[model samples]
Target: ANNPIWLIRNGELQSFGPDKQPIGTHGGEQNPFTLHEMQLEKGDCLYLFTDGYADQFGGSKGKKFKYKQLQELLLSVHKQSADEQRRRLDETIENWKGGLEQIDDILIIGIRIL
Candidate 1:
């Protein structure tokens, strides 16, 4: 599934955009990417990521990690420091992907408005 920009504000998790790949190597007359604009307040957290994390095939029974699980994980850690959040995310995914080769590149950028 395509990845949506995840935002956490006032302890709520929200998702937006991702109509298509943000960047594509092949140039074509495809519909222009949608521009998303929003107001972020102090303590709000935003996450931008590639689909690899959620698309990863892991965990017991070797199932996909899935967006719902990823959402829950993010919500649980949005309140932590950036470094801690990074560590937890890394550890969790690694543990989940144990003994399996990674399926794709994973990139997650998390920002906390101050």
Candidate 2:
């Protein structure tokens, strides 16, 4: 998954992660993964995910769902509880996929600080 990290801080939705590598192998360019630090306020949320969902081939034209739509979905669900957001995300993907078989493993984690 190219896009592995996302954050909603201070009512803004932003994406963060390394550009050269994936979860392992250190991207070949470096010996170790680069780390980032950010300050979070109350009610802030963090998200980490793999590319399965966005890479899915579906929709009217039968193309990949892509990352843009997924980002919009996350922003829209920002007002909801974590569990409800999860449900809506699952529902959206399932509906998008329709009867087609799922092709890859999809993983998403949502963390909100109160």
Candidate 3:
């Protein structure tokens, strides 16, 4: 499965990076990993995260949290202090999870360009 990497740059939330094809040492001719390059402006925020966050089963219908919703959530809180942003993200996901055990590890990094 080709999952996209989410990113936020200069107040714009977007997703890019990583090819959908699986990587293996065995018998299939697979696409090589793409080399992505980007420039960061002062105060820009960049995020690198695992699929677990978006794939979480939660919300009103116990559906996946989703990339779009995640994007919106981050956008709304991007202007807050870095620590505050992290806290909010954690709190939001935890509430959404509603005490369910997540199958995968949740790892998200938010970098603010200076």
Candidate 4:
């Protein structure tokens, strides 16, 4: 992806002991995307997502959907229209989470090159 890497964390919300690592410390990489210098010709799209969207648990007793499932969902909808892709992604997350509470804030963005 050519888009900038965005990081989000909430230390106040995380529950961690003094000796243990913080919950959100591993949110993202320290550096932004290295492709910032690249220029897009046209008709390029980049999508970035956070784990919150895929880590959600639901179903009968609740279970984490995991990253593989999220990647598959993205690949399946990769060729669809941008709007449709977003809609499908949202729907998939909602369906997977069911009534479970969201564990963390989710951030996803789609950028279209012009």
Alpha-carbon TM-score of each model against the true structure: 0.92, 0.87, 0.81, 0.58
Tens digit of lDDT per residue, candidate 2, span 1-114? 357578987668887865655556543454455677888888888988888999888888788888899888988897798789989999999988987888899988899988
Best by TM-score: 1
Native-referenced Cα lDDT, model 3: 0.79
Estimate, for each residue in 11-32, the C-alpha lDDT of model 3 and write its tens digit: 7877775676765565778666
* lDDT scores of the candidates, listed in order: 0.89, 0.82, 0.79, 0.58
Question: Could you tell which candidate, 3 or 4, scores higher by TM-score?
Answer: 3
lDDT of 4 by residue, 2-103 (tens): 222322122111111122233344665544323233344354545565567766887566988776676566556655787898899888878878888888
Tell me how far the alpha carbon of residue 54 in candidate 4 is from the true structure, in angstroms, after superposition. 2.0
Per-residue C-alpha lDDT of model 1 across residues 1-114, encoded as one tens digit per residue: 257899999888989968754476556656767778999899999999988999999888999999999999999999999899999999999999999999999999999898
Off by over 4 Å in 1: none
Off by over 4 Å in 4: 1-44
Question: Considering every candidate listed, which one attains the maximal lDDT?
Answer: 1
Assess candidate 2 and give its TM-score to the true structure.
0.87
lDDT of 2 at 48: 86
